[model samples]
Target: MKTYNVAILGATGAVGQEMMNVLAERDFPLNKLRLLASKRSVGKTYQYKDQVIACEEATPDSFEGMDIVLGAVENDIAEQLLPHAVKAGAVVIDNSSAYRLDDNVPLVVPEVNPQDIQKNNGIIANPNCSTIIALVAINKLHEYATVNSIIASTYQAVSGAGVPGLNELNTQVTQVMNDEKVEPQVFPYQIAFNLIPQIGGFDEMGYSSEEMKMQNEGRKILHHPELNVTCTCVRVPVMRSHSESLTLFFDKEIDVEKAKELLANADGVKLVDDPNNKQYPMPLDTSDQDLVYVGRIRKDLTQNNNKSLTLWCCGDQVRKGAATNAVQIAIEYIKQNA
Candidate 1:
């Protein structure tokens, strides 16, 4: 079997740890595994298979001789480590906002932009959690019916902000349940029993950076420069899984049955639309699954020519939204390079 030496930066963080699990779960070809974190995390050990490996302080030296470096670190750390990996001849699959919009780095979703892998300058970017989930559900439709516009709203999980956010949510929920008023920290406002319509810092236009990523990243991944999208990102009380309600305007009349059949066969999508039995995709159902569960399909009442279709999609932000996608990019790279 072919083998590759792999490095996972920020392995102690949520996405980093999930990257390790995804690698093992997918049985990625690894001859050596290196886990790197900050100085504060040094000397810590994480279990991989039956062996325990120490976490090293991440530096340029960490990439020496490694074939692939899975950059599961923060944006700042990924910025520092990515170039170092490139200098050391390692292919980097970076899960960060750092290099995503960089003209040189290919922002990729393996299912949509696998060919973009060939354009990598030793670094490939994983799309944002919101963008990844949105495109996965909408791309196939764009192909068949020519999606002209999209209006989407995302119900993001606290976990998107990492472990601290999850802790804050849980703690705040407990306090509120006990009839205590909780203060917000990780989020700008209280998130225990409330929804925060803003995610990431708001730009001058009032759209959060998270909301704009769908249009920016979608164009790159779908190779559709003219595609228009408007999104609202909200932090929901859910601990994991992200849900999106999308209204798509297609170019032609869409047969409802045809759309269902198309989505049922799409890669990484599972259709669960059976409202008669009160069946549809839910965060609770998609928490652990790799596939993007989609349902609640119906033609839009306000648009003609079946130009609109409303649907819901759910995916684990930590899994397909982060780690699994990175691993899939690496696998695609390895396959093409082979």
Candidate 2:
């Protein structure tokens, strides 16, 4: 058995807390564990099996002798800590979007591209929540039939924005129920019982940052630069789990049954397609689930050339998308380095 020292950056945030839960649940080997957060959360105690560890302010020296640093902070914080971790001879598995597109950094999903981790320049990136769930279900299909294009629309949860986003949604819902006017804070538009078509800031091309991530990150993970993706990411009024409606266009003709068969046996994906009585993947069913739930597989009616297939997928974004993937990277690093 190999043991390694681990540190969780942004230890008081939502993704950081989720990383702690995943580390405990997966029983990861830990010779030493450290929690680093902002000044506001410093000195806060987080317990695991009676071992109460105090959260410290994350600085350049936070990575001292650390074997692996699980980054659960924003892109700026990740950008700052990544080099520090590398300087300390610790590999950084970041959950932020900072390094996802860096030519030197490897954007990895253990199920889709475990080999990508081997290309890491001391930094591995966990992809966007919607992209991770979508790719986990479709990468197997892509393996058999190459993907030429993807049209995805995401129904993401409030939790994707973190705990404060959830609180803002819940507060607005309460205000509306009480016949009072609701005010939006964390989101650009109202998010209670409403859908905000924007997940991240808009780019010059009119696509939101969250929407473009699917295309940019997909190419890196699949090693397919010409893979075109058109996505519209929406923030829904849900607590957890992100759902996506995907219509994938393959280079070769693909049969729906064959695609289902391929996805049924794919890693990190759970096929739940049973449309006889309206059974398929849903945010409610997929919440807290580790596996990416995929269903609603069908041939695209508009594109009758047998090149396109539509599907629905759901998964716990914080787990499979952020924390679980980061922890898996840590495990892979241990396996290779130990």
Candidate 3:
């Protein structure tokens, strides 16, 4: 096996830290690992197996002599620095929405489109975590029955917002328990015991930016140019992992039993669909893991045909959605080149 020098652009955030952990967990061949963050986090240290890695202030010069740079930062920071990494001859697998829709950058989910990794020109963009999970849960069904339309309602965890979001939820819950006034900051409103229907700014059509991603990124990744998606994104009080309810319309007929059979053996997906015993995919059980757990299989009564069905899925957005996805892309890149 060969090793590569890798750097994580946003080494201190939730997703960045998960990326580091996933690399170690999956035993990514490593010659060197560099952690990069803002000036405030410059001296912070993190645990990676037996080594204590210190974070450095990210600069254009930081990408020099690196085989790969895994981006786990916001779009603004990624837009500012990733180009420099590419110019310095390092392939970047970004977890941000910075270049997801770019014609040149491939928005990848290894379970859905591993071949897309080879078409990258020094950059590979990981799709939104929700998009990744939703697509992974249904990709096999799409293959067997040709998914034509998607109806999704996402119950996203506070961790989707990062560390501050998690802290806000914790603080609010504690304040509520103490009968104190709760201050809303990390989210638009109190997310302690209530749900926020909006995840991002709403468009003229009343769809949030996060909702539109289910369609836009899904179209790009699945290569289903005509795929239709109607999505509703809600911020729930859960701590980690995201759960989605999906109603799919396929071109070909597919029964509930068939859907379960396909998903049970699908790659990157775990089947937990025994409803008789009250077992189904849930965020509480799916957190801190890579595979998307899918269950609650049933025929969509509203569709009026065998061509439509519904299912539920859950995945750790921080891991499978961001960090782990980028690391998997990097691993594929390494294997493809080798």
Question: Count of backbone clashes for each model?
Answer: 0, 0, 0
TM, every model: 0.97, 0.97, 0.99
Clashing pairs in 2: none
lDDT, candidate 1, 1-338, per-residue tens = 89999999889888899998888898999999999999999999989988799999998789999999998878887876689899999999999989888888999888787898999889899999988988888778878988878899999999898888889999998998899978888998889889999888889989999998998888888877888899999999998799999988888888678789999999989988998999899998888668888889888988666678988999999988998899999999999999
Lowest summed lDDT window (length 10), candidate 1: 302-311
Q: Highest lDDT: which candidate?
A: 3
CA shift of 105, model 1, Å: 1.4
Model 2, poorest ten-residue lDDT window? 329-338
Q: Rank the models by lDDT, top first.
A: 3, 2, 1
Residue 229's C-alpha lDDT in candidate 3?
A: 96
Per-residue CA lDDT of candidate 3, range 1-338, in tens?
Answer: 78899999999999999998999999999989999999999989999888899999999899999999999899999999999999999999998898999999999999999999988998999999899999999999999999989999999999999999989999999999999999898899999999999987999999999999999999999998999999999999999899999999999899998998999899999999998999999898889989999999999998677899988999998988888888999988898899
Q: Residue-wise lDDT of candidate 2 within 127-215, one digit each (tens)?
A: 98888888998999999999989999999999898989879988999998998988788998889889999887898889999999999
